[model samples]
Target: MTAAVDVRARLVDRLEASGVLTPGWRQAFLDVGRHEFLPDVFWASTGDGYERCDRARSPERWLELAYSDVAIVTQWDDGTSSGQQREPTSSVSMPTMVASMLRDLDVHEGHKVWEGGTGPGWNAGLLARRQGAHNVVTVELDAVVAAQAAANFRALDIAPTAVVGDAAHGYLPGAPYDRGILTCSVRHVPPALIGQIRRHGVLVLPFAPLFGGGAVARLTVTGTTVTGTTATGPFTGSSAFMRMRQQRYQAPPVDDYLPGDWPGDAVREYTTLNPLNVVDDWLASFVVGLAVPDLYYRRSNNGGSGMTTLWLFDTGVTSWATVDFVDGASRFEVRQSGSRRMWSEVEDTVRWWTAAGRPGFERFGLTLEGGEHRAWLHQPANPLPSPRGQD
Candidate 1:
C-alpha cells in the first residue's frame, strides 16, 4: 500500500472515533481520494499567516497535509494571481468541517443534492459516491476552478454535472433538490436559494455575521416563492469558511473615518474586560456578532511599546472606537467617537453573553424569514436582541 492510502485510512479512523464520520458514510469516506483533487501548490494557515506548500518541492509533507484535518488554500484572489499577494479565495475545506457538514446534510440514497463552491471537488466527489453521480449538481463561480474540478472528477471516473456560475443563485436546471450544501459561508441565507428548494428540504451552510465569528447552519426550507419562503435550523457547530465571493464585505478605508489626527473628536473611557478574551475566543466573537449587527473590528500593535489596540467600527463609517491593551495590565485605555457607541455595544453584548452562562454554538439557532436573518438562543421564537443604534 502507498503512504497516501495509509495516511487516508488513519485520518478516517480518527474522524470515525470522533463520531463525525457515521457508519453509513464510512465507505464513502474511505473511497474518496482527497489528494486526487489537490493542485500543485496550496497554502496552510500558521496563525500569523498562510505558508505555501508545493507538491514538487516537498512531496511527503504535501501528501500529509492533503489528508490531515486542515483547510488547504487552492486559489488566490479568485484566480487572478498565482503569487501570494492577497487573501485566499478558494480552498479544499478542513476535513472535520467537511465530515460534520455531511453529517448535518442528513442525505439519503437517491436524494438529489446541490453543492455550492466546488473548490477542489472533493466534497462533490464524496456526495456522488453516496448519492448517484446523476443526482448531484455542483456549481462554481470561477470558471478556471470549475474546469480543474471537472478534470479531477473525470480522472476518478465520477461524473457529477458541473455548472459554472454563482452558487448564490444555485443551478435552476436541477431545481427542487432534496438537499443543498454550501462549501463557502454567507452573511445571510439568500432568498433565491430558498426559492429553489422543495418545501421541508434541508440546506446546510456556514452562516457568518459581519462582526466576526460564524457557525454551520442546518436549515429546513418552508413556504414558497408565492407563500414567503423561509428556513429555520440550529447551529450544528463552529466553523470558519471563506465568505461567498458575491457576499463579501466592503469596509470603508481608515482615512475616510479619521481624516486628520488620531482621536480627533473621539470620546475616551476604560473598562476591565480584556480585548484579548473577546478577540481570541471564537464563541465569544459569535455571541458579540449575533447580538450586535453591522459591527466589526481590526487590531494593531503600537510601535515597540508592547501595547495592542483593538479598533471597532460600524458599516456606516461614522463611528470608531479603539481599546489599548498591554500584556499583564489590569486596566486598558479606550477611546470612542461618533453617534453610535461601537465599543459600548460590543462590551454590553459580551457581558450579556457571560451572564447567560456563555452558551456554545449548538445552543443557538437561526431563522431566515421575510428577507432578514434572525438569530435566537435555544429556540427560534426568542430572537437575540439587536444593538440599539445602527448605520
Candidate 2:
C-alpha cells in the first residue's frame, strides 16, 4: 500500500479506537479514500500550523490532509478561490463532528436520509455505505460545489442522488425522509424540513442563535411538530457551511438609520470579551439593553495613533458605536436614528430571559406551524409568565 493509504488506515484505526466509528462506518472510511473528495488546492490544519494543499504542486500535502481528521476549508465568501483573502464560506466539517452528528442521527438499515449542504459528499458516501446509495439524497445550494461533489462520488463509485438547489427548502422530491441531517449551521429551522420528515423521524442539526453561539440538537419529529434538546459537552469547533443566501451578507450600514444625538448616556466599557463570548452571553447583553436602551457604545483600539473599529450590526438601526476606554471604564456612543429603540429591545429580551429563572438556551424551544416560527423559553407545561413590560 502507498504511504497515503497507510495514513488513511491509521486514521480509521484511531476513529475506531476512539469509539466513534461503528463497524459499518469503519468499512465506509476504509473504502472511501478522502483524497478523491477533496480539491487540488485546499486548507490543511495541522497541530503545528495551517498549510496549503495543492494536488498538482504539493501532492504529498494533499494526501496528508485528506487522510487526517481536520476539516479543509473549501469555499471562502461564495465560490472564489483566490487563496484565503475572502471570509470562509464553506468547508468539509471535521471528522469528529461528522461522527457525532451521525451517531445522533442513528440511521438504520434501509432508512432514507436527506442530507443538506453537500460539501464534498464524504458524509453522504458514509451514509450510502451504511444504508445503501439509493437511500441517501443530498442537496447543495451552489451548483459548482454540487458538481464537484458529484464528481467526487463518481470517483469513489458511489452514485447517491445529489441535487443542486436551496437546501433551506429540503429536497422535497425525496420527501418523508426517515432521517434528516444538516451539515450546516442554521439560524432558524426551516418549516419545509418539518414537512419533509416522516412521522417520528430523526433530525440532527447544529442550530445557531440569531445573535450567535451554536449547539448540535437532535430532535424527533412527531406528526408535523419537532422537539429536542441540546447535546451536552461542547463540540466547540467551527464549521464553514455556506450561510443561507438571504442571510449570507452582513446587514447594511447602521449610520443611515441612526440619529446624530438622541441618547441619554452613551456608555462604553472595554474588556477581554470576544465576539464568541458576546454571542454565548446573549442574554446578558439583552438584559443590559433593556435597562439602558438609549445607551450607545462602540469598540475601538489604537495602534500608534491608528484607530480600529468594531461594530455591532444587529442592535437596531445602529451601524457602529463609538468606543472609548480609560482607567478601566468603557463607554459606547450609538449612531443610529430609529423609533425601534434597539437598545430597549435588547434589554427587554434580557429581562424576559432573566425573570424566567435565567433558563439557559436548553430551556428554549421552537415550534413551526406552516411558514411561521415561534420561539419559547421554558417547557409548554411550565412556561415562565410573560413580563409585564414586554412589547
Candidate 3:
C-alpha cells in the first residue's frame, strides 16, 4: 500500500479507538477518505495566520496534512484569492469534529438530509454514504466553492445535489428534510430551517452568539417551533467555527468607542471579580454572551507592563465598559458609560453563573418559536435571564 493510504489507515484506527467512530459510521468513515475531496492547495491555521500547503511541491507533507486531524482552508476570501491569503472563507473541518457531528446526527438509512456549507464535498460524501446519495442535498453560498464541491462529488461518483445560494434560505426544493446539519456557525437558528424541517426532525447547527464563544446545538423541529440542548460535553473543547457568510461579525471602529474627551460621562468603580477569570473561560463567556445580547469585547495588554485592559461594547455603540487588570491585584477597576451599564451586566452574569455552580455549556438549551429564540438553563421551562433586564 502507498504511504498516503497507510496514513489514512492510521487515522481511521485512531478515530475508532477514541470511540468517535461508532459501528454505524465506521463503514462510511473508512470508505470515504478525506484526501479525495481536498484540492492541491489548502491553508492550515498557525494560530496567528494560515500557511499554504501545496501537493506538487511536497506530496508527503500534503498527505501528512490531509490525513492529520486538522481543519484545512479550501478557499480564501470567498475564492477571490489563490489560497495564499491567511483569511479563510471556507474549510474542510477536522475529522474529529465531523465524526462527532455525524454521530450526533444519528441518521438512518433512506433519510433525507440537508447540509449547509458544503466546502469541498467531503462531508456531503460521508452523508451520502450513510443515507443514499439521492437523499442528501448540500448548499453553499459561495458560487465558486459550490461548483468545486459539485465537481468533487462527481469525481467521487457521488450524486448529491449541490445548490449555490444563501444557506440561511435553505434549499426549498428539497424541503421537509428528516435531518438538517450546518457545517458553519450562525448567530441564531435560521427561521427557514425550522419551516423546512418536518415535525420530529432533528437539526444540528453551531450556535454562535454575537459575542465571543459558541457551542453545537441539536434541536428537534416540531411544526414551526424547535427546541434542544447543547451537546458540548467536557470531552469536546470549544467548537468555534467560521461564521456563515451572511452572519459574519461587523464591529464598529475603535475611534467610535473612544471619541474626543472619552469617558466624559463614564462612571468609575472597582470590582473584586477579575475579568480574566470571567471572559477567559469558554463556557463562562458563552453563557455571558447569551445573557448579554449584542455584547462584544476586545482585550489589549500594555507593552512591557503587567496589565491588561478589557473593553466591552454594544451593537448600538451607545453603551461601553472598560476593566483594567493589574497583575497580582485582588481587585480590578471598572468604568461604564451610557444607559446599558455593560460592565454591571457582565458582573451580574458572572455572579449568577457562580451561584448556579458554574454550569457547563451542555446545561444550556435553546427554544425557537414563532420566529423568536429563547435560551434556557437546565430546562426549557426555565429561561435564561435576558440582559435586557427581563426574566
Which number leads on lDDT?
Answer: 1
**CA displacement after TM-score superposition, residue 338 of candidate 2 (Å):** 5.4
In candidate 3, what are the lDDT values of residues 77-179, reduced to their tens digit? 7767752564678899889889888877779887899999998889999999888889999998888888888888888799988888888988999997988
Better of 1 and 2 by TM-score: 1
Task: Find the 10 residues in a row with the least total lDDT in model 2.
Answer: 228-237
Per-residue lDDT of model 2, residues 72-105, tens digit only: 7777767775555456666777777787678778
Q: Write the number of the candidate with greater lDDT, choosing between 1 and 2.
A: 1
Q: After superposition, how far is residue 204 of candidate 3 from its true place, in Å?
A: 0.6
What candidate 1 gets wrong by more than 4 Å, as runs, is: 45-51, 225-227
357: Cα error in model 3, Å: 1.6
Q: How many backbone clashes does every candidate have?
A: 0, 23, 0
Q: What is the lDDT of every predicted structure here?
A: 0.88, 0.63, 0.81
**Clashing pairs in model 3?**
none
Q: Each model's TM-score, in the order given?
A: 0.94, 0.76, 0.91
lDDT winner, 2 or 3: 3
RMSD of 1: 2.1
* lDDT (10s digit) by residue, model 1, range 81-101: 845458788898878889989
